[model samples]
Target: MTIKELETRTGMTRANIRFYENEGLIAPSRLPNGYRDYSERDVHKLLKIKLLRRLQISLSDIKAIVRGNRLLDEVLEVQLQTLQQAQEDMSLAASVCETMLADHVAFSELNAMQYLMTIETGARERRSDYFEVKGDELPQVHQPWRRFFARFFDMMLYSSLWSASMMLFFNQNPSLQSDASSIIEGFIVLMIMLFVEPVWLHFFGTTPGKALLGLKVESDDGGRLTYGQGVARTWGIIGKGLGYNIPFYNLYRIWKSYRMCSDLETLPWDEDIAYTLKDSKKYRYVTYIGGIALLIFMLYTATAMKLLPPNRGDLTVADFAENYNYYLKYFQMDSDQYYLDDNGQWAEQEQNGSTVYLGIGFSERPVFTYEVVNGTLVAVGFETHIVGEERWVGSNDQYMVLSGLAFANGQKTVGLYSKLSQELVNAIDSHTFESFEFSQDGIQMRADVTYAGYNDFDSGVLIPMDGASSFTYDLLYEIRSNNE
Candidate 1:
């Protein structure tokens, strides 16, 4: 029979059935798929447990009887005596209440000391141990909210560290796309916390967040947890308390844990563990908030720095290329425009047909070439043949290409405007097509636009749009430092 069928037959809740099983009162066999396979014996056993529980039998006694350590009748006899003693106490309390009502006793004038003395005397005469409560069994304090926030703080700290490390060392950014990559990233962070949290608990008895909240997780003996105990407890919290942080199941587990804590019941993870809380000043909360805020700030700062181009100070050719590539990648620009060859020289991306940029068609992609003087980049330039099969040199397409070249030369996206002269900027903005050159602050800029064509052959055949009859053109743009 299934558990649901068992629930129906025995008239017991799933929780009750599971609790009894956990207490070793009933042991069900497991099926191939890891589900419990209950039998008729389990149904009968659960019914017996229900009846015994109704008779106020404790689970410990029931477990001993189920295990054959004690006879059922013997346990029943002890329970019956305990119940008879409880009945006597209730009768004595009821008699006192009846007497008070018969005398019409008012609240303010009630003889409390007289009633207590009477009850105490009755209990002594009956030789009952019910009123002799043990002081050592007092309930321990529970701080569910504090514990939850402390764990949350620790998780956030771990996530931030992971993000910063990936961005700074690995040059990898968190994925903005909604995909399994995000879930995988979260899993990695959880794994990191799993291993790291145990070390903190073993050595310090608390994590950073727990320290801030004045909370400590100790062994039952009130000492720091051993490494093995720490691992077990942390794993228990991840599995039973947090449901391994799986989406909807995590919420259910969290609610269940909260209820257990609120009811002052020992959490499954803390079964043989102890939690101690010191009197914390109110400023601890402030510090915790500040710590979380600082982590978030650092995470964002790292992301921004990773996305930005390299610094502008006297850069080598490789450094300049790195900055340029960073801009292209960050903006998701077309990456097929250029590439580095085997000798580290910029080479145009090869294609079967012409490529277009800023509405202007070209026979080849523009390639960037740089001159390095004394290990510092001093000049950069590129030239490409523009297809004129259906376009003219003075058309708007030419103006658009010129404008794009001006923007590219200024390195506008990277905020490196010092590379372009103001005179060149104004001329380009004014759509001045004639060859012009200007220098400012040791930086020189020039542009050369020509209308021409050339015959190109490949495999003894004329390449299309490469003959002099075709009205093709070429554009050359360059920027150089006079210091070179």
Candidate 2:
């Protein structure tokens, strides 16, 4: 169709139609010959434009309304307001014209008055049509669990009540210097509730905070959370936290956190909603509070523990010393070289691939003894005597304990332990027997031991001993002596 045809249909001049195109109100095609090619769609648009113009809608608003960008209800509401203004302008014009006609004003003056009244009345009827909705009309929904958690957890935990509780717990006990271990335990528990719980609830069946916040967990498929889902989310947190908090393990956690967050964002929501922290509502306040609270709690715990009293009555100074010597004698082990298989099992690097054993056990008070079976000694139990420091170490496949002792000669002793075995006896015998530390229940001693050879004597792995060789291997293990 030609612009002339649109002009004939809408009664708008061709120049006006061209003007509308220049204003970006409409777009008409052009033929190969450069002639304007207006389609039926263009005719419809022009008809709509003429209708809106009759209603006094501005070109910009008419464009938006025609594009279906503005909601129908919204446009109708503006039209209603415009109608009301037009009615008011008509009434005002009738009154002004009546006064001019009755005053017998000069014909020229009356014409001028009539002209001015027409302009003023028309202006009065022209309402400012807004393309946006009124603020009050906007709708809001309940905050998501992630968003809520990002808000309240920090405020509650870091509150005066929580801090005071920690301060009181610490002040009552001396010799309980806040160490890495104690701080970690408290933090792990708190995080399991605050950070981990919400995520777990979303991935699992329910989390306490989510429950309180009326949130529900679901798989990407929208299926209910399975037991396995719960465990994965729960333990995933434990594993991730350990990786982040533990020495070396934490580096892996940090890297995993970043990768997981990035990957989660890109995951197809239609396929899955296993969102990471990044998916939680975009609010930063809750996350900031949680992070700050964690830091404060850690520092406060450490400072409070330092000010607390030692757990002195668990064992006397003398008895502690005797038990210390006994453990130092047996639990230590010597090894030439250790091999860690791809499966994560630790065995002697020899062709036989024998497993090493380093076991330690506690006897009566003043008689602490240990045996090294499998696994290296990481820490002694005596170090934990300060209270809240008696921590355990473990790999995915196994766990270990560190025992404590104070020697009879006023020297402190601590020992490392595992299951009982000849391999452990041999490792103990290979030590150089150098220096030692005291503990309430045992003593810790490190010495150099030469590896005689590898052997398997009912032990998964054994390192043979050549009569008391010296190559100091630091031993760490924990003992929970019933004697205490």
Candidate 3:
């Protein structure tokens, strides 16, 4: 028989027959001209597939039937149970509709709470079901995969948000990075989960992830949870769901949460929330579609970011100063009182008072500033802050980096500092500060007037000094400042 004959005999469309053939459910011999030549076996198999499909038997089971691995009665038993369960669900839905119709409930008033109350009332009257122990104990039961995906979606959302916050909140001083950054990021994620997740459950009874899995959060007593109960349920899952990066505790929570999501029994948190999960496949095939969409979104973002080139590694400070935006990617930097000049270099808004420049280095995080006097890079400097101390070290020291006082890596990172000079420091210390200038390696150093804080030297902090260094002033400062 030809495909048209097979289609007519099986009462299935040609497209449907072709799909089953493509799925490897039925194979027909190819004629010499390359056209399909269906046999009686193909027709018989299609009929069996069609019948089982009407009974809602899975294709895999039908394959077993076609291969003679299982009897129709054996397969029908499982189908019968599924049909019975579906019938019960339909009866419950019909009852709810009947109640609404009896109460003259308006379509606008037919919300989740109304349906919930209707179902609970019906279940109680029949003595067939209990919300706490009989049905799903929580909204996430038997849905480990959906729970895993919900967390994945959440983490991906937070990862992108945190990456953006590197510019949003900390764009001014990223070098302040510490353990506190992680805590703040976690807090932000928590707030979003609370706002978006619970509100969604309140209205729809399913999260975006669970909606795809055809799962809904069933209420505790047939009616919906009170506002407090909703909060408890949301936090019970999410609060205990994440462990704030607690060493092995986070992993343990993930594993335990996964188990709770998959198990039929109530989780420890369920005692507080008092809810269970129920299948709502009739709502839609959302999980599959949503999962695929989310997967695509993640891949696109990751690929786009990975394809971009990294910061300009070869550009010098002078080169960056000439056109900062060209190499802006390299600097993990933000400033509140800094603006770009026509030359594109960063300019400070105020020059009279001390201003600290904090930034992430090409190496480690560093805090420092460059001294500028009368439009000259007089001497670049670095500073080390002791949290409880009142004073700053490397505050005025120009030989800081080469002397091992503020170095990162080795010579490769020297460009991160200003030109080294001892003449300027000596002039300031001896109260001989006057308008004088000297040039070295095309960079200049100069001081305007006498220093006022020389008497404060007794309380000064010592900067690191290297006995043997290649700095032009390493030996000069070592011999001169050793006695000071």
**How do the predictions measure up, each by TM-score?**
0.49, 0.24, 0.41
lDDT of 3 at 278: 54
Q: Tell me the tens digit of each residue's lDDT in model 2 across 1-484.
A: 8878888977899888998888777888889999988888877877877887887777777767767778656876888887887676666668667877787788665567555755565665564222123633212212333434632443344343344544455332222435875555545555544454444554554553343333455666556555555545545554653342465676676455545444542211112333223233434445455555675676555544322223223344333433332233222321344322222223344557666632222211111233322332223222111111122211100112112222212222222321122232333434212222223433333322222232324333333345533322222333333222
User: Which is the leading candidate under lDDT?
Assistant: 1
Q: What ranking of all candidate models by lDDT puts the best one first?
A: 1, 3, 2
lDDT of 1 by residue, 58-114 (tens): 888888888889999899898888889999988998998898789898899988888
Q: For each candidate, what is the lDDT? A: 0.70, 0.44, 0.51
Best by TM-score: 1
Candidate 3 lDDT tens digits, 1-484: 8988988899999999998998888889999999999999989888878887887899888888777899989989988976776677668878777877788866777566867876778667655443335433334355566557655765555555555555444432233446777667666776667666667677776666556655556465555555565677767666576765454777898888777656654565556443344554544455565666766565544433322222222322342243332113224332445533333234554667654443433211223343333443323333222322222233233222122211111122223223332333354344321234444333333433222222224333323233423211111111111100
Against the hidden true structure, what lDDT does model 2 obtain?
Answer: 0.44
True-structure lDDT of candidate 1 = 0.70
Error of 3 at 72 (Å): 10
